[model samples]
Structures are given as structure tokens and as C-alpha cells.
Target: MRAGVCVILAMGALATMPWAAADCNPPMRPPANQRKFASQAVDSIIASYQPKFKDAQLGQIFANALPNTLDTTVFEHTTSGELAPDTFIITGDITAMWLRDSANQVAPYMRFVSQDSGLFSLISGLVRRQARQVLVDPYANAHQLEGSPPSPHTDDSTSTPAFAGTRVGAMGPTIFERKFEIDTLANFLHLSASFFAAAGKDQPTFGAPVNAAGQTWADAAELVIDTLRTQQASSEEEGGNPPYLFQRTTSQPTDSLQFGRGAPAARTGMIKTGFRPSDDAHTLPFNIPGNAYVVVALREAAAVLSALGRADTAASALALADEVNAGILAFGVVNHPGANGTVLAYEVDGYGNSYFMDDANLPSLLGIPVYGWTNTTDPLYMRTRALLLSKANPYYFSGSVGQGTGGPHDGLDRIWPMSMVARASTALSDQEVLSVLEQLKGSTACTGLMHESINKNSAGSYTRPWFAWANSFFGGLILDLAETRPHLIFA
Candidate 1:
């Protein structure tokens, strides 16, 4: 579930270390049989690294986190015939699965899919599950595991004619929360292509029918493309009301969009998003990183569709990606009053309004390179990275304990470990990466697992004690470091 506290104002900043020592003996993981799922390949990974890490604390952290999702959250079912198996993953504190979080939770296991058939089936099954969810409602971000259950958030109107009335399933118990986040859809597409590339499996592996509704991965991809295309219209272009509208009855101002539709956006070619990946409502209609992510996700979708012989759909995906990329370049870049060069705005409206702060979520400006949207050396991304890490970006915080981006999602004076992971993943040098890792070690509050957002001054104070996405992402970072710079861990 999305963390509370959407207040955008950052309070006074202070720099001091939180009193949380790294536990030499971290809590042991749950017993093997008690684990929700297990894999020999993942066991091999932990065994291989445990002896190699020069820092035992980091090693223990890796061991606990790398398998956190499998150990605690995953539920898998295997079938005997042509139908692909089914898997449903809960986003740690929440019983429902978020398309975005579930994908990231299993991402690190991609490499091991071929080595462990169990792991392969789990990931492939998740792909099919996502397709089913997409077919259920492309506008929904979080979804329930089974038949429509009671929803937690206040009822919102999804019945209006918006975005071609594609938000039809928006008002059901099947969807946990119906916030239209573009990255949620994009991540599904990326995961589909990534899964195929890793497993070397196709057709019955993915294209086989998933439900009686005739839902398949290909059908989901088509709907996602169409939804994105429909959202590219400006208010004037659409002629009447915007295509999507979200309203949640809550005291939090950011909980609901103004007048059901979000801030008005001109036709900038970028697809408008109702909310960010954080599940916070957007200050502006167009989310730059979200659009950039769509570009990459679209290209990945194109690859999968092309291989499946859907040339027309594949071509359409590629064309949409190009149009979105062009839109980002033309409208997302801005002259930063506090920076040496122009940088990418975090969010923008087609009609000259923009928000500059970056949230500590995936698809952030600082994570463009990490997201495969751009390279570190790209002048614009480099400039934006500097600005985001400095005082220029309101959400960025520095303290004696750690320094990183936080978002309005968790309010002021907080730093998210996910941002630090993104920083390390995108860093240029071994020292730079190590610095971030050291901060992370101290910010875990001796729990040995990652949290949603920790207090910049006090690591003990944080949100979402059981955030599996951050844990898995942190584990993935360590895997990457071990593979590329062994000395960082081995020394």
C-alpha cells in the first residue's frame, strides 16, 4: 500500500547520525519450510557471497534481503498442462499485488530463472498474473489476488467517460487502489520482455490464454499501448473533459485530484499520469521520468511483440515510444535557476508549469541511467542528478546518518533507502558506490532489512517496516556490485 503523509513542504534540515549500530549478528531468516517459497539457485547465491564479503554485516544484510520476497511473500501454483502456472506476490505490508512492486520484487531473480526451474516458473507465472491484472483494469495500480474483495480506500467515480472509458473496471473490489500510474503499466511490459529474454521461453510460456476473457500477454500489451496513446491528448485536443479522473475521500489534499481530473496538461506528446509511482497524486499532469520509462518499456514491448509475429502492434509500440521520447526532450527539459545547465523537470504541464523535486522512487530523474532510459554521461541527466542530490531538490535530505531523496509520500526530513540504492547503482566510481552503501548500513536501524523511508536524523524512525521492494532492490544492488566490483565486497 502507498505510504501516508503527502505534505510537500520539507521542514528544517539537520545533519546528525541516528543511533543504530549495524548488528554483527542480524536476526536469522525464518526456517526453510516456513518460508513461503524457496530456491536452490537463490541458496547458492547467498552461500557464494556470504564467505566472500569482507564486511559480515553487509553480507548478512544481503543474505536476509536477497530472498526476502520468496521467504515471506510469494504464493505459487504449478499446473500440469499447456496453461502457464500462476503466481501472486504481495507488496510486503499489503496483501494485494502492485504491478510495479511485484515486478521489482522478482527482478533480481531473473538471472537465476534459467538455473532454477522453480524460479523460472515463478517469474513466468507472475508475468501471466500481471497480464490478467492489466486486462482487469489498465488504470489500476494495485490489485487483489482473487475475486473482488472489499476495498480499503473511499469510493471514487471511475464511471465517467474519460480516456475512452477504459477505466471501466476502476470502481471494483478487484483493484486495491485505482491510481493511474503510467510506470505501473510500463513495468509490466518491461517485465514481460525481460522474462522472455532471461528464460528463452516463448508462446505457451507467455502467449497462451490466461483466462476465459481471452486475456493474454499480447492483449495486455495492446491495451496498455492504447491507453497511453489516448492519454497524450491536451485538454483542447480532447475537446471536453480529460480521459481519466480519480477522487478519493480523504483529508489529505494530495489524496484526490482537483475536480476528478488532475492538473490540466497541454498536448506535449507525453502521456499524462494521475499519480506517481509513490501512489501520491501528481502536482502536474505529465511525469517526466514516468514518460521516459514508457519509452524504454515500449521498446521492450516492441521486441516481445515482434518475436511473437505481431508486427503491426510492435510497430505501433515503437512509434509511440518515439513520440513519447520526443515529447520528453521538447517539454521536460527546463532551465534550473539553481543549476549550471538545463535539467529534466520532475513533473510538467504542457502549459508552462513544472515541479522540480524528484521523489526517491524508481523512474526518478537520478535513476534515468539505472532505468536504462539514458546514460550517466548524458549532460542533461548528469546536471539533473547533481541538482537532485543537492539543496535544489526539495525532497533531497542530508544528515549525519545518511543522505538521499525522499518524497511527499512520507513527508519531511526522511531519506528512502531505495534512493540510496539507485544512487549506488548509477554512481560512476567504486568509492562513490561504497559511500552510499556505508550510509545504508548505518540507516537500517540494526534490523538488517531495508525500510520504505527512514528518518534522516534517526534511522529507528521509519515507515513500512516490511517493505519487500526496497529489500529486494537493495539485494539486487549488492548482486550487481559483486559481479562488477568484487573488491567492494571481497576486500
Candidate 2:
């Protein structure tokens, strides 16, 4: 997932921190059997029975799912000097911390924060750490954890095999990968607002200066808004922004942007991104789902800012959010022959070129509703969702076993579990939700854990078995199901 321009977000679930070390929310019940599918943090959670779910047949599966996201991945402790902030969450396979995945990995645990002191500190520290990383280099999607070795990708060299006019630069002291994807910043801001909300709900004083080192959550929110404003070459109404250049040396074509930069933007008010969430370079810079996500994230940011006494900043973000949404509705939606009336393009260069399909990553067409940018029932979203879930989208795939949207970052025909889980988040009938859940139960593969992308042709064939985001997200869905339709668990 390391990239200079394009990004394919990463996947995998592995124990960076052992079960013995997990001090957050140990399971409240003992195991029913000795077989353990994951590390101790998960095992402890799964073994404990929720009395509310005692009568449900598949209740245990629901319990195990979300915990899989936390225990199997996430290194609970990371410190820079004396600040031992107990948060250094890495994606399943990568040694570096992804702003997107870490925000998500810590999210499912929000329900327990009020009762779990360990978790409160863990997420709080992460909130601070993520804000710092954003301040350091908001363009970089991933960062180096303290005490970790330099990534194998630490050198700047011409990335293309052509090695045409390659330029290398010294690596930042703590950057793991510096791909400039818009969702990275959006995720950072969203996480800040989310944590602030969670902390506030837990207690009124949680994010005050005394607790947050004089840096109120509002301060972080403002920083995000200001940086986003500066990166605004996406609008035709705006002028050229600051100079930002990045380079890396590798033989892989996807390792870096082919030209060391993206095409010129028309400034449609959509923020410019060097790469898509897939971590792949976008032919066009104004990624549609990314713009949509910024709107959604800014909504959260606006609320956070308002509460933090930065009403002016809140309004600014909200205005930008509206502008981005307008850009999406205008330039982001394009007519496709043979498709329904109209559909959302995955990307628009603001110069007439638009990518007609979606990737399997978040901020994708199928994921738009999941992120709260629009309702699933919204006609445009529904149309685009249909296209993405079917063969019309190049990455959507189906075979004998299962099918979903795939990305080059994972593999061909490898449907991402996140995409699958996202389907359930939309406006679905109870039975439709059940059908999806049944598929997920079978999609876990032999490990009894969610893989990043399951094999389309064979249930047994898969990749990235230790994906905590997939597991936690899937588990979160199940928890939602349990609340809305408990019978689905038994059926």
C-alpha cells in the first residue's frame, strides 16, 4: 500500500501485539471450548457470553467478529520519547500505521470506552498521535511507528521500470509512505470528531486542554480544515495552490505516479488527491467518492468545531463540504450509455475526463452510503451502486463461490469483505440483510476469520486473513443486526 501517487489501501490481520499484552476489555465470559481462533484479546472477548445474546444460536459469531478486528491487529502501545501514548495501530500486514485503518480499527471499541479505562487512554493517545501525524504531513497516508525499522520503501528512486528522469529525495524521519490520497486526511478529521464525540459522551471533560495537552479537539479540527483549504486546487473557482512533490524509486509501475504527479486539475471545488483509496494513481484527480467523503467527514468536523467554540471554523468546513458536494453532483455525475438514467463517476479530472467505475475501497460508490454521504436509496447512489456491484464496474467480480468488487492492491477477482459488509449498511430488507450475513458466515474461509478479500471462485481461496478492519466492521454489522433484528441471528 506504500505509494508515491497511487494507493491501494492495505489488508491483512496479524498479531502485532500478543493477546497476553492486550489490557483492553478482556472477555467477560470463559471459553465454551479450548479451540481459539484468534489471539487472547479476542479470545477473552469471544469466550465471554453476552446474556442478552444467550438465546441466539450464532451469538458467539457476532461476539468474535468485532473483537477479531481489534485483537488480531493493532499494536496497543507506541511512544515517541516520554509521551508513551498507547496507540500505534498498524494495518494487518504492514508495519506502518494507516490513518484510514487505525481510525476504523479503534472505532468499534467506542461503545466500551466509558467503562474501559485502558481503551479510553488507548484511543485518546491515538487521537493525539494521529493529529500530530496530520500536522507533520497530511499528504502522507501512512507513518512510521516509534521503534520500528525503516520501511524497505524508504528510498526515493525512479519508480517506473523506464526509470525516466528519476529524482530521489531524503526520507522524512518518521514517514513510512507518503502517498497523497484525499481520504487519508478525511479519515483523520473524521476520527478526530468521532473520538471527541465518544469522549464527550463518556464525560464532558475528556478532551479539555488538561487532558489533551492544550490541544483541544477543536484545534485539531481547525488544522484539518485549514490544510484542506490550502490543498484546494480542485475548484475551478480557486487558483493554483502550494507546490507539493514526492518521488520514490522502484521497479513496479504502480509503486509511484508515472509522471511524479497527477494531471492538472480544473479546480471544481473538489479536493485534489494524488491517489485513490485503493492507493492507485487516479487518471483524474477529483475522486468522486473522495469528494463525497470529505462532505460527510466535514459534517462531523463542523459539529466538533462548533462544540469546541470554533464556530467560524465549523462554518467554513461546512461551506467547503457543501461546495464539494455540489461539485460531486455537478461534475462528478456523468452520463454513461447503456447504464441507468445517471450514475456517479468514480473520479472526475474537472477537465471533462471521468472514470466510470468504482474501486472496492471506502469512499467508493458502494461505500458512499456507508460513509453517510448519501442515502442508499438516493437514485444516483442506487444507480452507481448497481453498476459497481455488477460486471459493469471493471473491478466487480463473481464466480462459483462468492463475488464482490476487487482492487489491484489486493488481487483479481478477490472481493473485499469491506465491500460485502457495506452492502448490508444500505437500505436492505431484513431478509436481504440475512442473505448477506449468511454469505459472510461462509466467507470467513478456513481460519474462521475474515480475510481482506475472499476468493470469488473458491471459498477456500483468499488473501490477508488477519484484516482487523474487515472483522471489526463485519462484527459491527452483526451487532447492528442483533439490535434491529435479533431473530436473524437465530435463523
lDDT per model, in order? 0.85, 0.67
What residue pairs clash in candidate 1, if any at all?
A: 16-400, 162-243, 163-243
Report how far off residue 16 is in candidate 1 (Å): 10
User: lDDT value for candidate 2?
Assistant: 0.67
Model 2: worst 10 consecutive residues (lDDT sum): 6-15
Once fitted onto the true fold, the runs of candidate 2 whose alpha carbons sit more than 4 angstroms away are 2-61, 78-85, 157-170, 201-217, 234-242
Once model 1 is optimally superposed onto the true structure by TM-score, how far is the C-alpha of residue 94 displaced, in angstroms? Answer: 0.9
The TM-score leader among the candidates is: 1
How many Å off is the CA of 199 in candidate 1?
Answer: 1.0
lDDT of 2 at 1: 64
Candidate 1: tens digits of C-alpha lDDT, residues 263-370: 877998899998998888999999999999999999998998999888999999999999999999999999989989899999999888888999988978888887
After superposition, the stretches of candidate 1 with alpha carbons farther than 4 Å from their true spots are: 2-25, 80-83, 160-169, 201-203
